[model samples]
Structure formats: C-alpha cells, structure tokens
Target: MAHWNFSLLFGSAVLWAMLIPCRAFPTGAPASACENMLPVHTGVQPQPTRAPYEFLLSSPSFLNGQPINIQILGPAYKGLLLEARSFGSNAALGIWKTPPNNTKFLQCSGNPHGAVTHSNTNLKTRQTTYTWLPPNSGCPPVVMFIATVAQSREIYWTNVKSKVIWKNPKATCGAQMLTRTWPAAALLSSMLLILLVYL
Candidate 1:
C-alpha cells in the first residue's frame, strides 16, 4: 500500500509538470533576441508553414523623420517582435514611436527603439501596431519589415516579412539606393513634362 501511494504521488507530479507551460519570456523577449531576431524558446523551431498574420503598412512610401504605421493582423498570438531594415542590409533601421499598452520597445544594435516586442505573454491577441521613424536622411530607398510571432511556446513563425516599402519621393535615400528627393527632382519632372509636350 505504501509503495502504491508513492507511485501515484510521483505520477501526479509528473503530470503537473507537463501541464505547466515553458514560458521563458513571461514579460517580453530577451536582449539576446536583438541579434538573432529569434525568441528564447530554445529547442522549438519556428513553423515552416506560412504565417497566418500579415503586415499592413499605412502607406506605400515613407518620408525621412516621418513615421509609418504597420499593423499585424490575423489569428491570435501570444508574443511578437518587429523590426525594420534597409532593403539589402541586415542591420535594423529607424526608431519606433512609444509602444502602446501591452507592448514594449527592444533596442537592437545601438539603435534606440530599433525593435518592438510583446510585453505580455498571456495576452493572446490578434493584432498589434507599430510606428517606425526612418532615418532623417541616409537610409535605403526601400525598407523591409520583419517579425516573429508566437502563437504558443511551441508554435511560432520567424522570418515573417512584408512587401518592400518605398521611401517618399520627397525623402532622399541615405544609402543602398540613392535618389534625388530634392527640389531638383520636381524640377526634373517638370522638365520631362515640358519635353513631352514639345515632342
């Protein structure tokens, strides 16, 4: 009888342990996530299938020092991290506006507000928004938005990406892709129009 009781107790403990979640990031993503852009849920791989969420950019183009709003839409998720990078470079670019309720900013690679991540792990939310402020002058002509979304500890997606967003015709590309977003750009357009009319 004594042996049976001990066996039952041990089984119960194991069951309880299995029930508990492995929440490494109970508050938010760790600082280590900055470089890898990956969550700390070690041993678990991001889902190979397509992510259910999508990034909706408020505008197709953005201006220097100007902000563009990006929203994640789709199935409910537990945590997420978002970053913006120049089209070709792996480096994250731009800062973010203050994080909204239940969200926080993650600084990556010396860039303040370089990234944004979830503040609450229990909140299974379907949507979130972020406002990105691109570099004032020197930045790529096009920006790419990437993210990691976790539906649960074991279920998540990495390398989530959005379509390339263009820099406003009024804002010059700092590097990567150079463009003349100055008064001369407008003057050149006017010149082209006049040339077309004459021809």
Candidate 2:
C-alpha cells in the first residue's frame, strides 16, 4: 500500500511539472488578452519591479506608409506583446510589416494588425526586431511603443512604454494601392472576365 501511494504521488508530481509550463501559454497569448493586455495565466500576477526590457527605435520620427524598425533590448525573454499607440490612448495603432520569425500579430482594437506577440514561447531571445507601418492618413503628432515582456510563464512585466516619437510634418503619405472607387474585389472580377474571354 505504501509503495502504491508513493508511485501515485510521484506520477502526479511529474505530470504537474510537465503541464505547468506548456498548458497556460504555449501557443501564445489569447485574443481576450487584447483588452487588459494581461496574459491568460490566471492568478499569476505581474512583477512589481521594473521591466528589464526596453525599445530601440530606428528613428525618433516615423513617416506614413514607411517601415519603422523596432528592437527589443534586454536580457533574453520568452515572450512579449508589443503595440504602437498614442500617448494617452489604449488603442493599438499602425500595422506590422512582416513580423519576425516565430512571431505573429494579434487583432486588437478592431485593427487586423493591432499588436504583435510571439508565436513560439519556446524560442527565447534578447534581441528581436519588428517593423511597423503607420497608416497613410490618420496619425497623431506623436506615437509611443508599449509592450509586455515575459521572462517565463509566471514572470512578466506589463505596461512598459517607450519615449514618444514625433511624426514628420513633411511626411508624404504614400498613395494607397487600392481605394473605394477601385476596390480589390472589382479588380479581381475584371481579371476573371479577361481570363474567361481568353479561355
């Protein structure tokens, strides 16, 4: 009886150890996390101490429709959620231009590219670069980068904000490839008609 109990307890312990790391946040943070910017690790609290992470922008100012390079600097971390925003606003701004390897964007604030998060929690790195593209027309005079860095499943820092960057007043917002007058669907239909006639 004692031996059986010992084996049962040992198995349970090993199972818990294996599950604790992978189950909570293996794939990535959930879409629900967009609102509060909180991880789904229920009951686990964020670190009160300052985040070791910081942002390194390619330039102090950004231009519309152009890519701005952003780098996260610090000791290696397991995962992160990064977003560009106005100083006092919670909504995420801009679109991600080709996210880094092992990462993907989350649809937050109704924007398809609202926030960027790691797609693979197993890959840990200190230096990762992300590209952000501001919308062509709507932009505040200044924008900031905010992020939540996770060192592990239970250890993370939230609301890490960078110094604001001004928008270039002389920025020439690039011409959009598509517009309301010439929607993408209409273009697709035209191509199909041409193909059918040729066939």
Candidate 3:
C-alpha cells in the first residue's frame, strides 16, 4: 500500500509541475518578455498629443509580427479611418475606413490598399476595434497608427506608435507550440505508463 501511494504521489507531482508553465505563458503573452532584445526608445515623451476628438487607443508596446489588436474609444463620429503606416516615410501598410472607398489615397506602401481583417464599431459607446496583420518582410522597426474621425464635417486625428521586434515565426512560434503541447503529451504518456505498471 505504501509503495502504491508513493507512485501516485510522484505521478501527481510530475503532472502539477507540467501545468505551471502553461498557465504562466499564455497564448497571447505580452512582449515584455522580449523587451531586452529590442532597441530602447528613450528620451522621447511617452504620452501622445491629444486630438480634437476625445479617444483612447490600446495596443502592445512591442510587436512580434503577430496580429495586433487596436481599440479606439471616443465620441461617435460620422466617419472613422484607421491606418497603419511605416514610421518615418508615412508609407501606408493597411487601412480601415468607413464607406469602403478604394481611392488612391488609401494605397498602402505604393501597393493597392487592402481592407482590415476585422473591424467592429459601437456607436452608442463610440468604441472601435481593429485587427491588423503587419507585413512580416520589409517591415520597419517601428510603425504608426493614425486614427482619423470625421464629426459634424470637421476632422480630428490621433496617432499611436508601436515598436516592431522581428521574430522568426518558425523559431518563436515553433518553440512556443512545442512548449504548449509537450507537457500535455508527456503527462498523458506518463499517466498511462504509471497505470500499466502499478495496476
């Protein structure tokens, strides 16, 4: 009986240890983990200049070519345009605007404009959400998001900038993918082997 209990306890400990890392590192882990790997942007004021329209923008401080989540909050406007552009050259990369216009002004990086993957707007609360996939190749170290609003025939704009950290998908995602699955696989195999031996 004591030997059986000891085996069970050992198996339980192994199972518990495997679960800790998965919970600690979630699928959408923050970029803070790679902060030291990227260049530090210092001596620049952190706060963005306020625009005529009241708004709030939420985005990660560091990007690793993952789909970026962008949220905008402000008063309801007649029209809203969100754009992603190269940091210094003002070259467009992607755009999301109301009315679905495909004019020359909407072109991205001299290429034809492409629509945003997902977009949602709540007029009552005046909030908007957008998902953007930045180009993996030839992308700059930093990118800017420009949110423009047209309210009552007047235009208001806000800018939010993010740092881009290049991560080889094969390396980063592959390792994380293994990390997420390896523990579960090992746990199952260990539990089955233990059962076969003990029973």
Candidate 4:
C-alpha cells in the first residue's frame, strides 16, 4: 500500500507538470514568443510626394521687347495654372493652369483688369512652353514674370519663383538672318535722285 501510494503521487505530479506545460506553452509561452517575433505588417502604401508643377519653368527669362519663352523641362505637370509675373516691369500675367500648349501663346483676357498675355500663335514650341510677349516700345518699369503652379486638393502644394532673365532679340536672332542688303546700283540711283531733287 505504501509503495502504491508513492507511485500514485509521483504519477499525478508528472501528469500535472505535463498538462501545465501544454497550456503554458501554447498560451503563455506563445504570447511572449510571438511578441518577440517579427511584428505583423498591416499593409504597405505609397507615401505622398511633392507636386510635379513645382518646377514648371526650369529656366525663365524675358526679352524687353520680344517675348518670354518658358520651358517646362521637368517631369510633366498638367492641370496646373501658370501665372507670369514681371516685377521690375510692374506687370502681372495670370494664366490658367492647363496642359502645356506645347507651343501656343497665352490668351489675353479682355477685362480692363485683365492680365497681360502673349499671342496664341507666338507661344509655339516642340517642348512644353508658356510663352508671353512683353509689351514693346516702353518695357515695364520693372518686368519680371512669375509662373506659379496651382495646388491640387491632393497631397501636393503649389510652388513659384522668378529666376528667369530677359532674352533680347539680339541674343536670339541668328547672325545669318540679318536684314537684306540693298544693291549698290539702287543705292546710288536713290542718292542721285535725292541730290537732283535738292538741286
């Protein structure tokens, strides 16, 4: 009987120990094990970024009498309003944010307070360009055009700056494309005619 009681106690103790580990290993041990293990990822989404229109005119410049051609050299930025500001000239050009006209002049509004504009025909380019012909004869007191990109409701915001220069016709015109030369005979004949008339 004494031996049987001792064996029974030992067996019961082993059974309890085994059962405790079964419960602890699955629930208690696994809870901590999982906690230490790599965490579960919810999901991966793309983070929002800056707007494309932030840099519309990579190089901006103006010609006192001619025109101002803006090159949209950066990634395509459509649906953005472009406003050209000529500060020293004290002029404001407000252009709608639209797909680059490729080569189309900025339309001038008829409103008295309307912003100045470049002829639609003049704004032509193979690349994306916002063209504006500054008024000639009397250049703006201080002309500086600003192309502002409008912000969308999305995560992006608008950006603007004025680093453009004044590109004079002299700089853009080719040397070979100069005015035609008058014939020597025609010049002499005209001179003789003028001299005869004076006499």
Off by over 4 Å in 3: 1-49, 52-65, 94-106, 113-126, 158-199
Quantify all predictions' global Cα lDDT against the true fold. Answer: 0.81, 0.82, 0.43, 0.38
Using all chains and alpha carbons, the TM-scores for the candidates as numbered come to 0.73, 0.73, 0.41, 0.35
Please give, for residues 60-163, the per-residue lDDT of candidate 2 as tens digits. Answer: 99898778888888888877888898867888888997778878888889987988988887665656789998877668889999888888878999998888
Clashing pairs in 2: none
- Which residue runs of candidate 4 sit more than 4 Å off their true CA positions? 1-61, 88-126, 150-152, 167-199
Q: Model 2 TM-score?
A: 0.73
For 57-160, candidate 3 gives per-residue lDDT tens digits of 34443244556566545565443445566545545563333322211123334444432211222232344455666664555545556544433222333242
TM-score of 3: 0.41
lDDT (Cα) of model 2: 0.82
CA shift at 198, candidate 2, in angstroms? 68
**Pairs that collide, model 1:** 138-174, 139-174
Model 3, C-alpha of 100: deviation from truth (Å):
10
Work out candidate 4's RMSD over C-alphas.
Answer: 25.8
Point out where model 2 deviates above 4 Å.
1-23, 172-199
Q: What lDDT does candidate 4 reach at residue 116?
A: 21
Q: Lowest summed-lDDT stretch of 10 residues in model 1?
A: 18-27
Query: Which 10-residue span in candidate 4 carries the lowest summed lDDT?
Result: 24-33
Residue-wise C-alpha lDDT for candidate 1, range 81-172, written one tens digit per residue: 88898755667788899987788988786876888888887664545668888887577778889999888878989988988988777886
